[model samples]
Target: MSFAADSPFKSISILYRKSHIWLNEGCIPCDLTAAQAIVIMIVCDFSTLTQDEITKRLSLDKSVIAKTVTKLEERGFLQRTTNPKDKRTYDIHPTEKAWQVYPHIREQVEACFCRMTQTMSEEDRQNFRRLLDTAARAALNQEE
Candidate 1:
């Protein structure tokens, strides 16, 4: 249940925080939080996606995403409007602000990610990413 100082998980966690902090600090002039940035990225790739859609995409629960999306909507970053085709469902739509900021934010984040990945061998990197995706899918497919 615990990790030593040099464990991969611990190092990765610290690196995650470092990268997140850098992203937040770099992306200014936008009323965006890192969480909101994540939502925007997901919605961009999966437009008109619903709360359940985001939850499934991010492997998070609906209530948590609902709360985050509510804040994003209130801040004018995203809109969780009712799906006109199916009023019973709602979908996430990005605002102009989100569209404008996405490219820069994604670039910065990708640069940081590249910096991290540079340490990995090409084969190991591909395998690691695939395995991570597999694990994520398995976790997401589990019963709620």
Candidate 2:
């Protein structure tokens, strides 16, 4: 069967590809891969996140998050300290370098999102985001 324009899988795949390329180019100055940059941003926003939390939030494999965190720690972009509440887990925190460039990264992400939704009306944008969020939550919940 031929793929249709309305296919959710195809649309999500296309969005993922475009977002990857955009983030990769945007993260060059930070010496981070798109994935790592995303993790850093999440950690900065959350202040304290564990590797498992990142894996869940990003819908990525635990090993991938572990490797990305290792790289970030190596680059001094983040710190992974033992979690006081959970002896078996480590809490991730963005370091000074991450905090310094966070504003730029945040601005780029916001601008990119704005550009992507520029043609949509306010209500359309709201509905689009709401649907995506709901879909994401459902997908995540389905895995558990």
Best by TM-score: 2
lDDT of 2 by residue, 1-144 (tens): 556467968867877787778878887887777788888889999988989989999999888889999988998999989999889999999999999978878876766666667889999988988988898999999989
Weakest lDDT window of 10 consecutive positions for candidate 1 = 25-34
**What TM-score does each of the candidates earn?**
0.77, 0.89
Candidate 2 clash pair list: none
lDDT of each: 0.77, 0.85
lDDT, residue 102, model 1: 80
Pairs in steric clash, model 1: none
